[model samples]
Target: MKKVHLGLDVGGTASRWVACDPDGQVVARGSVDGATAHVFNPAERQRLGTALAQMAAALVAEDLVAVGMVGGLTGFGSAAAAEIAALAKEALGLAPAQLLLTDDIVLAFAAQFQPGEGHLISAGTGSIGVHVAADGKMTRVGGRGILIDDAGSGSWIALRALDAIYRVLDRTGSLAEVQRLAGALFALVGGSEWHHVRQYVYGGDRGRIGALAVGVAQAAEAGDATALQILAEAGAELARLAQALQTRAGDRPIALIGGVLNLHGSIGTEIQNRLPGTPISQPNSDTALAAARLQASGEEHAWRAILASMLTPPVPSLGSSVSAAAP
Candidate 1:
């Protein structure tokens, strides 16, 4: 029998789902815009569950799997993976074929690292590095985001921008180049009087922090002194993050994904310069497509075992090791 399956990718700043036939050709796709990852919110969490239900009604399927950051990596996100599996398995009450939950990086690694001699670095709202060696030994670094990790991430750039802004506001520093960029942030467009910049900064930490990278880059391109500083700082941080990964990682191809690395001079140059001669390439496929591959593959990866062993209930708090707001 031909196997038709559904794969879900609940990742940073967005929620996405895909349906694929046994041949791995995509049949349907669904997506929702999210600033703070719905898996972290109760009300929004239903968006994923509901979307899956709707997809189930539309198509007959054999298996449905949701992979990505839903793994119990962080505390609040701990149950996201299982909750999704449960919803598909229990809530939607769909007959299960093979259901699996996992971290987003693992799927990307599976899709990109065919020979398994590579490291997948995801830099977006946050950043994480996963290494798949020739022997299939996986080592992850810098996945904690702005709080603990995410060194080359967008939020990391934004935090540096904020620091530059603070430095300027306090008159403790000079951002002659970055000032113009900061002005854009405060400046308004058209006749609209909405002060989204101010509101965004004050609204919440996770909400604005990750997305701030875009604005910072905009300012830097415009010759904003402070914005350039922010980008430079982020570039350095990106290098350091890459350095840490390269040091620990054995010889492997390094694949860089997410918005931060895509930009030419700002971050890519920094990372490439720091980690010279390393194989840094683009994502072979998107996270959603990777999710679909993982969905179709029935083999249970060892990543799940690591997650289960690490998260033995009563997860440790963010104590002194990490500050409250990641940014």
Candidate 2:
């Protein structure tokens, strides 16, 4: 039987997995619905298990036999670690020794820098900055999830835009006078009515709300001042995360990861402008692949080197204006 190792990167917005052979070659890769690591929540626990089962089914379809697995789960907490592990073992058919689980952000940090090497700023559905020290201790800033902070995160940006839109509506009594951002939000929410917006914001999860950032980015690209300002503020918020980590991270370079950073050029530009002279790099390596390698080798440098080898050349930076129609 051909042996394979599996790696999973589970987040609020999506879950990605990769299967790798002993030689570190990717054999199969796929994505399933997003799931949180909050196993204490019955709903979240079910979602995590379902996503794992779906991944298992995909592996079975490809005739892959997983020898071991590593997973980085969002919202992972020590209190729920055992429960999360149990769910993974039951869904993936793995033994206790065959599994390793960690926070998704930790895996992201490892993918880019070795412990004590750099700080990582991750802005996806939520945002956080983290640094792993030489002694394996971790220091974090601003990863409190959408309910609290997550300042520069996708959800934060979406909320800011929504707040602005509603404020305008309250004053004008009509969205007709509102510009590109209002239209973009209206189209995304499926209508301009208060009920439509409320339903979309309240009825859905954080991922759904965070997705509104896409429309916000589109509006900003169309020169909507509100959208532009929100994105700039987002960048500044992310910079603050990095700055906060500096007390412990100590002059380390910053690695920017996550979908929010990719939403618009303005976000990155603002980060750079706010934190002048700080070395900031955006590494595009696949975290799932890195996780797979870690499962296979059990050594940090081994997986890091393998992932580095697979890095694609960087694409040119996006211009100030992203191409998309408002709404």
State the displacement of the C-alpha of residue 157, model 1, in Å, after optimal TM-score superposition: 1.1
**lDDT for model 2, on a 0 to 1 scale?**
0.83
Q: What is the C-alpha lDDT profile of model 1 across 14-87, one tens digit per residue?
A: 65666666566886677644322245577656665565566555444534433221121122234455556566
TM-scores, all models, native as reference? 0.75, 0.89
> lDDT score, residue 252, model 1?
63
In candidate 1, stretches whose alpha carbon ends up further than 4 angstroms from where it belongs are: 1-3, 33-47, 57-82, 91-97, 133-137, 172-177, 187-198, 205-207, 297-327
lDDT of 2 at 197: 90
lDDT of 2 by residue, 1-327 (tens): 467999899976679999999878999999998898888789989999999999989998998989898788887655566798788788877886677677788888878888789999989888888887766656778877687789999999999999998898899976554479999988888998889999999999888999999999999989998999999999999999899888755889999998999999999999999888989999896999999988877774443343232222234476752211100
Q: Count of backbone clashes for each model?
A: 9, 0
* Clashes by residue pair, model 2: none
Lowest summed lDDT window (length 10), candidate 2: 318-327
- RMSD of each predicted structure: 5.4, 9.6
RMSD of 2: 9.6
Per-residue lDDT value at 325 in model 2: 10
